[model samples]
Target: MCGIAGKTGIPVENIQPITDSLHHRGPEGSGYYADNTLQLFHTRLAIQDLSDAGAQPMQDESKRYVLIYNGEIYNHTALRNKLPEISFRSHSDTETLLHLLIRYGTDILEELNGIFAFAFYDRGEQQLILARDRFGVKPLYFRDELPNAFSFASELKTLRLLSSSPLSVRTESMLECLMLQYNLTETSGFREIERLGPGKFITIDMRSQRRQTVSWARPLYTRQYTVQTEADWIDQLDTALQQSMQRQLLSDKPVSFFLSGGVDSSLLAGLTKRLYPGRQLDAYSVKAGAAFVQEGFADDYAHAVSFAQQIQCRLHTVNAQPDLIHDLDRIIYALEELQADPACFFVSDIAARAKDAGQDVLIGGTGADDLFSGYRRHQALYYYNALDNIPAGLRKAGGALLKMLPAGKVRRLQKLLRLSLAPPNERMLQSFLWINRSEAMNLFSADLREQLTLDTIDTYCAGLLAAIPEEHDPLNQMLQLETHCFLAAHNLNYLDKIGMAHGVEIRVPYLDTELAKLSALLPPQLKMKGSETKYLLKKVASRYVPEHIIKRPKTGFGAPIRSWLQEDAAFRENLRERVMQVCSQWPEYFDRQQVERFYNDTINNRTDGAYTLFALAAIESWLRQFTAN
Candidate 1:
């Protein structure tokens, strides 16, 4: 809900631009606090207490500890109950967190349930502590190159404003971005910046200049199967989701809904209407316009209208047929990190419309799919695993038939077959990668490919794969990989950037603390029963949503980028021109001949390189904008 920046062993004036750059994130007010060794800057959004008392860079009554915090502490009131002996001045959650930290120290992170990225400067110990939420719903970026100097910010752009010299482009991360659609590790696209992983915290002692990082949380994936029946599991899911929604509705302002007509968003719409009958919530959905709507894509606007009518809530639609060439520059600038996701433009359109309608808080459904196994790929993998049980001759015959099918399903079956053959650790990672290792190598220029041979790309992912707990269910391991890599790296990161870019705060109730714990306990079989993805979720959603809506196919909330590339001449021309420009600028890194060949192949539908083409376009724009002379 806010932007926070701080540095140790640096003057306060040096970090002011970071605060100034993030004014959009917190336009209500701004504050600064600095001592000899520590300085902190805060831009306030004023979600909870719309008063001066809510202003951040706030301190407790004793003034021994100053805090600059972003995001809401939904259980702050409950936590305050445990600290009855403490005196307080304001009702702001910032003050509540300060008291909790003061009383319980870092252990309070485990006791609290909220999304946040905050910096607490302990004036008593002359130390600085930076922490992010358990799920990384909030982002935190930091740099630690200079001796005895440490800086942290809520966004990469803000962190860039604090740099002392030109930032080195991390080509390794750029390669990862092009291959995977997001960074693999904490390494940012820049060499000097690093993202703090979710559920982790870092502490720096100004006196000794010692720094240490530690994990404060790990999701509970026990696979205990506590419930007795499907009905019982449905009830537990309902209770968990409703409780999470109740807590997420803690803001003083009116929160609106993002209705994609998908079950996740539709469920949110129904629950909000049913729970807060008098609040008059408004739901917003983006429509792919006449020229942009791809074949077989859902008529989300129509479905959104029907559902809104069914729930009796107001509906708003944003007709999103954006000029990809016109918006590409701005979109890349906002993303900072190069992500090939053209879906960002659609989300940005929705956020802008919500802001224009005077809605500051928007609720979304992002984590449900990852948590409950709601992807066709998940179903395919489940059946593919069963292929291991078939006799060798039958499995070989099945593979031969899969190869003879048309390319789309053929490629899917091939991937599943390969995944079934891969080691357990590598299977999930392979499922999420956009391209295979050989294809990535083919796309890179000869010089870049040579360098890649020296430094293998999978090295970073290997470390993460080895880190998965041995006791976790295989499906739970897959969920963890998707949550950490896809959700955190790609989905959540863009949601934060695009939403904050429009001054709208997006809250995901399905990712609530209690709900996460509940999800961790359910058996994988219940998560995706036989061929049904999100089976339990569908059952729970059936209570509030119509059976038809709950049973609809998952046409995710996205524009048809593949169709656009193939059908829209102007968009394709724009993409080609941009890629060529980047190739011209960095001939050493990108082979112009290979790039043009890829473009032509994709345009003629000879190769399914739409995703790679999109990623290249994004990277080209980002480099031109950020690395300009």
Candidate 2:
């Protein structure tokens, strides 16, 4: 993994500053290639081949096509078989991809697998291609506003470095991120920067100044895997996961594991042990304190110990209670663009530990929840169906009773309530968004609210849902949106940016192209059977993990938003200070009296604005660090 930057139709005095700024991502090597047509800068991390031959801004033997790539290509060796005609010097995947594009052109993206973001330039054709992996496991951002000028980078910070002027926040995107935990569209936090959607590739004709974007891949419900049986589904998932683990472990260095001891993380470490029983793997986890357990988080240290003992792997634990708020500023700045996920801190902490332990790569489990219908939103679909069958009066009575239930079940039922009130297109937000539309819009000043169109948000989501035909299952349709909006935009983006921030590369086995395809084919009934979420996954986990781990109540892998706001005195003070600061800075865009009122209401438990408060504080910090007048 590395950082990349390039520009077209603009004159540059130097690419040194841009390359230097991204040194954290790729501290090993740096290079640049420029001409009248294009300028490309690359900082390399040297994952595959440690020799000079692995250096990027690499070109074909003929030198007609040049490439600067980030990410590992697991199938590069296999792909090289197809390009036997080229006399190659380096064994690096970068060389493999360069030759593949030379032979097959842009049409090869659909067949390409692995997590990557890259720029491939064809000097002879005067065309440039910028592409991201199928699920956007790797991120790419570009600026195409200027008539004949174009720039692209691996992160938003590098794009800012290339800008001729200070960047302003994209108002709609900023508010959307605050309302939802992450941005739903390609629009970045800044007006001039735009995120490239997952599974997408854009071709730019440097000569004509015309660009065309195409979705070469997407979460497909092709029903291509025709295996049909409870046992068949279990076997298929088990086999695909093992195969994915094998491909993801392809690296020149030893790869470690991130073990929460939940079934997902345990299964990954468990399978790694199964794959190579003779070798012991290194696994890292957060030891959330008793104080954290009071906030309703899992005391994952015991579980981590259990799984490590079960697998005979070396476990390294990081104490979470001490550095929780201490790491906030560094993590917020590392995230660059604002993402309110508390997992960012946890993962960055894990990455730092992984780096110190001499491991350059860490295997993560992120996509299984979205792919296997493992969230409260998925559980809500079952409730939605049950509510649909009940009479209106009965449903109303049941809704009233749900309030009396225990706290844990109430959390799941709350999602059911959110879906019940929303339109079908917006139902996917049950898990993604923290506030309702009216509340979110009300948080904005009237002038800004008037400029924002509510229809566009639903329309974009409805379009993603439309990808799966109407005749298909409703849960699959919602899962498609969850993958595109939540998984791609939120989960995968942070994993890449924050992991790279510490010089640690995260490889997610579940997001492997073949494994994702297998998941797309598994029927919804297997994914969530009745109130159970990830039913098939648990069954697959049983073959490799302990029963205690498989059956644990799902404590999510995110920060405890409610408790952090209500119980933690230090964190609460930090939040209030930042919120007040932003209110003062953008008084024209936000009503200070209203925001303060909502925040106070949230702390007193009179309102559900903990998430909103946390996001606003995150935005305040990001604005202070990344934005300029």
Candidate 3:
């Protein structure tokens, strides 16, 4: 609910622009506090308290600590009961967090539960502590310079504004982005800025200019229920989700829900309706034009509308027209990178329209898929279990053979074969094998590739493996990796940038801390029963939504990029020319012939190269806009 930026060794005048760049994140008010050694700036969204007391940078009663915090502390009341000795100055949760940290030291992170990214300056200790939530619901970026200089902010752009270095692409991260369409911890398209990993707490000493990072929040995955049945699992999930939703609904301003007519969003909408029947909540969904190209699936606008009507909430359907695509450049600029797919453009538009309507909070069902195994690829586990009888060599050979078939069929077969051969905990990572390391290398210029270390992929994968327990079941290990790495680094990163771009707050109930811990305790079979994914979620959802709604095939909230590339001559031409122009400048890294082949296939409708092409287009635009200058 706020934007914060600061630096050591920088004048207050130099740091003001850094904070100004994030004005959209906090438009209600702004403040700055600085001395010769440090400067801290805050932009207030004014969600918790409209009074002056809620204003930040707020300090402790003794003024020993000053803080700039983003996110809500849902359990502040509970925490206050434990520390009755501390005099409460404001009703705002921000003050509670500052006092909690003062009382409990860094242990405050483990005691309270909420989505947040905050910086606390201990004037007494002469240190700056930066922390992000366990699930990474909020974004925090920092740049460290040797020997006592550091800068931190809510967005990379803020840090970019203050950094002395030029904006250059991190080739290893770019390669990872091109290959997997995502990057691991602390890496970004920009080499100069790094993201703080989820569950990480770091302290920077102002005196020595040194920093130390330690894990403050840990996911406890011990299976505690020896006698828990499927029915018990459903009941627990239902209760947790209901409680999370109720708590997240606390807002001084109006709250809305993004309805996709799927089980996840539909269930959220149904719950909100049941909780506050008197308040007609706003439900928003996208209504794409009839002429819009269909990628692999048809549009589900009608289903969303039907469900909205069923819930009796006020529905607002924003139409997606050709003109919307024209605004992609602006959206990409706001996001600071083009790595996000076309789906982001649609979601950004939704947030923009919601902001214009004066709505501040938007509840989304983003974590439901990752948490409940809602993806079609989750079926690979069952297929792999059945194929356990096959030899590893045969499965590898079969997988290579299947890659020659039609892309869609080949993708499914490859997933099954990989699952069969890979360790169970690794199947989730393997499922994301859209582009391989070789493909990534081929896409970049030789000079860029040489600038990057060869061990980047190994280092990233090894970090993931290190997080899993040696005795953990393969499926459980895979889930843990997905939650920590993929969900934390990529999915949540995307949501934070897009949602904050329009000053709209997004709350994910499925990722509620206690709920996630409870689900982690349930057996994996309860999560994915046989070929069915999210079996327990579906069972719990049955209580609120109809059978038909829960039974519908998964319809991803994404754009029809394949059809767009084939049919929209202007978009295709502009995208191809831009990519070629960008790559031409770095001839040593990319093969022009290979780039042309992808462009030709996409433009000529030879294949569904939209996903790959989109990734390339985003990278090209980002390079041209941020680096080429």
How does each model score on TM-score?
0.94, 0.95, 0.93
lDDT of 1 by residue, 1-629 (tens): 99888777656565557777889899888999888887788898878988898888888877999899999899898889999998777889999998888788899998779889999878888778899888888889999856777788888887777665678777777677767887753677787889999889998988888889988986556446575788888998998888899999998887899888888999977987788887787878887765444534566677788888888888888887777678888888877787878678888988888889888999999999989998766786677668777765666666667765543325566677766766666676677776677665666678887775523345655555456555366677777777777888788888888888887899999888889888988888889888888989999888888877887777755556667777778877787888888788887677788778877876765555677777887888888887774
The true-versus-predicted C-alpha distance at residue 495 of model 1, in Å, is 0.9
Tens digit of per-residue lDDT, candidate 2, span 303-387: 8898898788999987775343556667777777767888888888899999988898999888889888877777777777667
- CA lDDT of each candidate? 0.80, 0.81, 0.75
Where in model 1 is the C-alpha error above 4 Å?
12-16, 289-296, 389-414, 417-424, 453-468
* Model 2 residue 207 distance off true place after TM-score fit, in angstroms: 1.2
How does model 1 score by TM-score?
A: 0.94
Best by TM-score: 2
Clash totals, every prediction: 0, 0, 9
RMSD of each: 2.4, 2.2, 2.6
Q: Is candidate 1 or candidate 3 better by lDDT?
A: 1
Q: Report the C-alpha lDDT of model 3 over 20-72, residue by residue, as the tens digit.
A: 79898898889888876788888888777778898999888788899999998
